[model samples]
Target: MKRTNCKIAFNDKLLMLFAIPLLSFIIPIVFFGCRLNRQPYFNVARFFSTFIIIVLLWMVNRYILIWCRKRYPRFSDVRKRLLIQISTMLLVTLLGNNLLHYILTETIFTENPVSVFDTDHLITSNAAAMFCLIMIIGIYESIYFMHELRSSVQETENLKRENLAAQLNALRTQVNPHFLFNNLNTLISLIPENPDHAVDFVQQLSKVYRHILEVKDEKSIPLKDELDVLHAYTFLMKTRFDKNLEVNVDVPAEKLQKRIVPLSLQILMENAIKHNIVSSDKPLQINVFTDNGSLVVSNNLQMKKQVNESTGIGLNNIRNRYKMLSDAPVKVTESETNFTVSIPLIEQ
Candidate 1:
């Protein structure tokens, strides 16, 4: 729904071609030569031959409304574009008032050619040139639809402040400082060797900071509340690589109410545990699921030999917040033994 080039501004078409033929020659010499007694020099040769037949039917109705903006574009079929722009403005207002009554009663102000079937001056000069071509195409389509509705409400408030600054930069790369100093040095050595798995790893780090403050201004969420914040972020990446991290999550309680984007599966599982090689001899894994309607994820690879260089900006901020909330496209892929991504999903 974006096509808007109805051109016009060469200094507003040289100020409407020198102010509409000087207000169409001072409105028929101030109402037919000073209030009705007519003939102020035959109303200046019939208002300059009806301002050259209303500037040749206003340049063929502004090139048929700029070719009906590329054959009726803005959201298409509006009753077949008002029945082809009111039947081509009633056939260019009946051929510009029958060629301005045969150029004022016969060729350029009379010598012989008049007989253009005058049917009462062609229905009163084609109903006053079809009411000035329907008030010039209804004031140029209401100032181009109020400047395309204020540019679609300022591009939807700049994509809602760039989707809330990419959900607060994916919750500051999931509580950054090197992922909260490796989950507080794996909760200070599991609070003295597994104090009840360090109280469920501080309740899965307060349930992944309470699901990032309950879906930070959510543009999307569900997939079972993003798989309950990816099971508290894979239980703090399985207590920082316990048995070298796994993940799985095959999705499908009827595609878990399908929706996504907000921290898109914990920023693609923290970019597969930040660039791979999770430990016990390359044990990463990952996965996540749902296929046709998208979601996917994947993983595998195993790069990490001093990995930190990736400035990917969290999968380009979840592919620009799923292109401002959906139409589908986010894919990714890779191969030589997996990397994937996919995404789509949003339906609810």
Candidate 2:
């Protein structure tokens, strides 16, 4: 899952607000009541009273923090919030101490049981101090949790980006090797009858490599630049197949100025050739045009029964690359007699 900075903070704040008060109230009452031999009723009353106070404090503190966050332009600072929590805890502890001192001195059960605190008539004051201490501990835990959440989110995002880049690079590696092997075979087949065309093939192959190298690190290239490479590629295939291959291009001149994923057209062309049989008797017809906001490549399928070792990587690579750039998935359609791929055109 992709994690954003703001989302982590938001989640952490919510979890902290709910979890801390419950833990603080439950843990101390259970452990300290047993150790001090307090009656169950007394322990239960003390727990409920403390719980209510803690809940009130949590609400007030959260409201103040949220208000500060909205009012101040830079209230996102974790350090400042931590300081505020510490200061609030100290202030609450001092106020509670004074209020509890008065309550313990003037209230019932002052003389029957021993003073809860070391000093006479200061038991409530001592309880108040303990409450403040628990609050301070909760605040520290919340801060720690928030920090850890931030770090985890950042690391996850970094890993996701790196994985995406690696996959893209792997796809690129397959393309160059696949293209080279096919073009080399074409050159070999033409060597005996047309030595001149074979020489031209070698030059075209070099130009293709040069173009690939130029845009190897680029995420996308201008449509015109991609078309120039596509034309060079088709020229090589046409030289080898001659009249056996029929190609048509009908893109709007204005759209050629836009940007597209590099080698997108090349991938579609290769897929068409790999799946279909092309010869003088049955020439393969491939068409390129635009519909709506997409560049469409369609080919009449005269499929060969015995297909080559197809890894199904070309279409997958193109689809993944486009996904990174656009919201729409690259559209693919296959029928008994035709195959079409529609790729979204991106503005520069």
Residue 191, candidate 2: C-alpha displacement in angstroms: 5.4
In model 2, the number of clashes is 0
Instruction: After superposing candidate 1 on the true structure, give the runs of residues whose Cα lies further than 4 Å from its correct spot.
Output: 1-11, 15-47, 50-52, 59-83, 86-90, 93-113, 118-168, 178-225, 228-259, 262-348
Tell how far residue 165 is off in model 2, in angstroms: 7.8
Query: Candidate 1: RMSD over Cα atoms?
Result: 14.9
TM-score of each: 0.37, 0.52
Find the candidate with the highest TM-score and give its number.
2
lDDT of 2: 0.67
Candidate 2 lDDT tens digits, 22-64: 6446644553352336443335445544455555555555555
In order, how many clashes per candidate? Answer: 0, 0
- Model 1 / residue 313 / CA error / Å: 11
Lowest-scoring 10 consecutive residues by lDDT in candidate 2? 1-10
Error of 1 at 3 (Å): 20
